[model samples]
Target chain A: MSIDNPETMETPTGEALAEAPILTEVLPELPTVMDEQDLIIETRNLSKRYGRLQAISNLNLQVPRGAIYGFVGPNGAGKTSTMRILTTLMKPSGGEAYINGYSVVTAPREVRRSIGYMPDFFGVYEDMKVWEYLDFFAACYEIPEAQRPGLINDLLELVDLAHRRDDMVDKLSRGMKQRLCLARTLAHDPQVLILDEPASGLDPRARIEIRELLIELAKMGKTIFFSSHILADVNEICTHIGIIEAGQMVAQGPIKAMRQQLMPHRVLVITLLGRLDEAKEALLHVEGILGIVDLPPEDGKIRIKVEFTGEDLRMSEMLQALTSKGIPVVNFAEESSDLEAVFMKATKGIVS
Target chain B: METPATRTRISLNPLRPLLRNPVALKELRGRMRGPRAFVVLTCYLIVVGGFTTLLYIAGTAATYNTTGEVDGGTLGRVLFGSVVAIELFLVTFITPAFTAGSISGEHESQTYDLLRTTLLPERQLVFGKLFSALAYVFLLLLAAIPLQSIAFLFGGVDVEEIVISLLVLLATAIFLGNIGVYYSAMTHRTLRANIMTYVTILAVILVTTAGAVIALAIVEGLDPSTSSSGSEWVLLVARGIFVCLNPLTTLLSTQQYLVNQQTLFTFKYTFTDGTTTTLPSPWIAFTIFYLLLSVVVFFATTRHLKRIEG
Candidate 1:
């Protein structure tokens, strides 16, 4: 609940988290160390074929521990198929997937215990009360009856559904039901959450709430691997991203790294109240300045955009040089590249 | 926040975990909470009650008009047989409705993927749906026991008859329930599954009986003698095999044993090839056969589910 706690902010080491005594006791049948790999989710040449239609082909993905990985793809580009294979709900026609070191095909039970999966479209028992629904799933995970009450309470509070604990699940709004389903996923306190389109059909406010919840869960050291086509949502929250097109991984990396790779040059917009031409002339002399683009005046002030391929220090030095030139500099800021643009450029609009 | 008192309470409740099968518990809780279950139960009871009263009145009047006195033993047999027969019909009609939609319903509602991802195994999922549906059918059977017991108050119905009838009824429910669950797992559409389940049940009942009857008529024509000879044993064994396969024959044979203390297959067979055998009693044979068949169907369902979902 303490969002700003530094201890909670730090991502726990995979080994340390895997060796938690409570988890070991709850899942005694699973091996102590599934894999020594730093990646929490890994797939090697994972392919799925439905007759002649290949859903996924040679997908090699590595999601590090404690990463909010955004899986992006066009419709019917096999995002769901990949997630299904990873969750052990479906088998790949060829290759394999591993979660927390356990093979999805050979050690599905261990894989299931490590991840909580929420499908794109899921249904709840309408006649069950909210708390009872959670209790049923908790039992499915083999959480002890004695602990279920407390776990259910904490999950309800986390998803903001505590007030509707006694209400029938069907009576809740679509957004509330989605959150309740999220709470159900957290019943066993899984190390990773594989959510498929968690905010697919929600309104703007509901999508924001779901986005914030994912952030909170990441802060608590849970690896969140969710798929979404909503580029805006992924752009705002995802630390890591993987873009798939035509059953192939087109691009994947940290968000910051991806932005840099796709948009190599940074655009710096400088607004000057006076001597705009002098500021532009001075910026042109800076070493990293690739080009200077002219812009129309706003409020009797001129704006010039500089295409700079430089490090942070060089940009600061260029700003200092402009200030030292005695030119009236009103505002100088860099326009951050949008993720949507990067996604559009990376994918070829191919779908399988 | 572990309170010593609450922890002790949990540990002492040994049945807590055993009773908490997620699918069964959820199904039962949902079923009992809804008004539809209550409405169905009420309608079932009313229909049974009305039928029982009608059978009693009709039997009493027929006996009084035909004879100088009303024979309670005959009346008892008539009432018990009618009530058991009605119950068999009800169970056969209702078991498919409850089970055939279980798995397919999950898919239709878009919950099947979520369920498959859980720690619950395929066998547990299939059995959970099976047991939950059977539990409701068993409740319906239990509710009709009072009507069945009404015949016991008269002279002819004995404890053995009631037990045997109940066994046959239960075996029929198990068989039909398994069929329903099997089809549910195999088909994606609930309507198709339910239709196939009923078709399979009808085939088991009607086709086997018809086949046996036709085979018996042909064998009788070949011999053309009403003699109590070894050749007659062939006809008896054929009837026994088909009778064991048919639910109606199984229940009726149990009823006949209660009334006459005779096995369904009485004649012994000694073939010209020097083989000699006597068929087992219909109730016992059918119970074992039905249970074995159920196990086969249950596994088939689980295997199909795993192959498709995994």
Candidate 2:
């Protein structure tokens, strides 16, 4: 197969490995993009096409180490497909991908060692108890026999399924099963965790629990790359985010940067003890107040939603100006960056 | 994360993965934990054991010894053949049933990808599934030994004959079981994999037997006056190979040769020109062919899995 990077030239495959014999010579060093050595996962112009349908097209994604990178996209926008390629479960039709320093196509074994993948839909072996299930996977990774018991126990405790360690995997609830699967991905203690729609189909409590688990894992210094169509899940836990639409990344960077790029103005919700029109009238003269809309009053207090392009100092000055007019402001808070706005606006016309 | 030293295993021990395969271990645990394995084993033993008792009773009452004395050796041979035939039939079908779902079931349950991502390697996955599936069948084979040893009480079937029979039975189990694994690797649905495996094995048996029969009929119909050197001899060798291809025919023909004591390892064919040649006996030929075939199937399945993993 031909690759865009002429330096690597030929992709090392089974036949290539046989012909070359020496692995080091056959597998050329994959050039890191823009000298970002911290990128745990990188895909350059990676594309996959099934017949005439292109699942992914010229996709470039870079997830740095120890960053909770949220890959948000509409359905069928190549989230799972890209994750599969990175996990070495599928070959890209074109271009190349790397996990750490290992080329995914040429060095799949290394890539598999570096990353733990949890797919969108997964099932457990019904006959296996929770501990046995973990042990089985641990053995798959060729973990030493003596260490498996300790590792399984540690993993079970981490997922909070330690109390149910002896129960059959089939008996666990959907939420519990998801947690167990997340634990299964950790059987090898991989450097990167690629989870696809981890919180989908979970109840609110379970979703929150999963969110907390991810946060905890991130705090442990793992490079977590997860995909979600649920924007709230992305907005909650992701430090950096990539928004994909129509099989291409439209926006990607730190979550704050992407949010700012998607939304040019901040949303300020102000609650007043006095009249609403008076606050609106005072806000019309404030600097950086692009527009104002009166909101539904809560608890006998008038509320107004303000669209402002400003900093913290500008917001403070505006609040001071409103109270100076005897507007009696009860609350003035700027809305946090809502990834829903980024997801909706970025993936606007793509029909999944 | 695991320490850097233990992250990757660099060993030359080829059997290391197979020695302790998680797939096989997990499969054995799954198979034995349920009542399904026990139920199947019970049914298999009943069929083989039940057949032996019925055959023993019938052989006892038969009038082969017209002098009113029982022919113990003849009765023993009859019982041995009866029991083995039933065991072979059950093993042929039962072996594949255990293996046919091995890989495909993983796909159906959505665990195939999870299993593949690990460092388990493809060959281990294939053989692990094969061993775990055939382990129970092998157990059934071993369990039937007592019923087969009934021949020893009557003093006809020797240990050599018993060994050859078990060898053929083991070969048959492995061949059919590997075929199931082959189809399992090729397909996503277990039911379809099973159907394909059964069809392929049935075709092997029917085509070989029918081909041998039809070739014999055509050769017999040819003019007796004509003298064709090497033609008839080649046909004899061809017929022997064909018979050996079918496990049932191989068992019967090998047993027949052992009873005749004409040859142990080979059959000598005399041509019209008074030249003679020897061909390997049915059991030897059958065992060697199936052993090589099983190896090929194992490698083919591994290669297919590697491709699919991509």
lDDT of 1 by residue, A1-352 (tens): 2222212223255453344333222211211222324799999999999889988999988888888899999888889999999988888899879999999999988998999999998998878889888888888888877788888889999999889988999899888988988888888889999999999887544665687788888888888999988776677678789999888898997888999999899888888888867887787777988888878989988888888897887689778889999888888888767787788789977762
All candidates: TM-score: 0.86, 0.87
| Each model's backbone clash number | 0, 0
- Please state the error at residue A292 of candidate 1 in Å: 3.4
Tell me the deviation in Å of residue A86 in model 1.
0.3
What is model 1's interface RMSD? 3.3
Model 2 docking grade: acceptable
DockQ of candidate 2 compared with the true complex: 0.42
Who wins the DockQ comparison?
Answer: 1
lDDT of 1 by residue, B61-110 (tens): 88663558888888888898888889898999999999999999998988
* TM (chain A), candidate 1: 0.80
lDDT of 2 at A268: 88
